[model samples]
Target: MASLSSLLPAPTQQVWDRDDERKAKRVGSALVVSQTSVPPYGQRKGWVPRAEEDFGDGGAFPEIHVAQYPLGMGARGKESTSNALAIIYSKLTDLLPSEVLAEDDPTLQKPDDEDIQDITEKTKLALEKLTNAKISAAMPVKAAPKAVS
Candidate 1:
């Protein structure tokens, strides 16, 4: 069987180091805020702004700005928090692998439609299962006492 690297395309004519340098610079400045305190229950109707910060100066490079906020307290809040964390995790992990494998050759072709479809179907089924479990958990259950034998 061919090794994984053997399947990849030859490195492009562009300088790999230059691309790595750019990625390093951008990732070095990337900021991720986590573990922020949630607002009191029903204190605010929806997402509440907690803090905001700006970085970099008005120079050759544009400044970067970020706003920090926590979801409200309840089911909606929990879902929002979960989505926010997922996004942050995806962004961070997306950068991590590239940084480690910056020198690796790029794939010659995009993923086939069948592969994408298969993944989508699997994801949908998994989500359906999770939703079913959550629904079952939320439902009230009755317990029957056993009579003496």
Candidate 2:
């Protein structure tokens, strides 16, 4: 199989775990809550979390890779290529489980359809709250007026 880098140049490869450099590393934010941040300016700014730095122990967290698509003719170019790589990284990272569990654990298997629906509904509600908080956090701060000289 062709690597994501094969699709473009200067691909940004992030590792949630550094155990192996040859394979992809899944970055799970749930693993490292305290280290996460949203900085201004940059590919991941505004809620972008760092790979290994933001994720927790490798033994527990799962990893995924997400890449972004380009917007113009240069979409296939270097910068766009990097952007695509980042998109892929994000997608992959997002799919990872919050924590790894034993295979023998029955809880690891998918639940019944009704359970699934219930889980989905709960997830949606949780996401709604999280989104609201995130939007509130992203709001710009107002500046105080200066006195005339």
lDDT per residue for candidate 1 within 53-140, as digits (tens), equals 2111212111223233322333233444346545454465666755444444466456789989999999999898787777766666
Per-model TM-score, in order, reads 0.25, 0.22
- Angstrom error of the Cα, residue 143, model 1: value is 9.3
Pick by lDDT: which candidate is best?
Answer: 1
- What stretches of model 1 exceed 4 Å from their correct place? 1-108, 143-149
Give the 10-residue window scoring lowest on summed lDDT in candidate 1. 53-62
What is candidate 2's lDDT per residue for 51-133, written digit by digit as tens? 54433332211222433222232334444434644535347667786776799898778788999899999999989878776
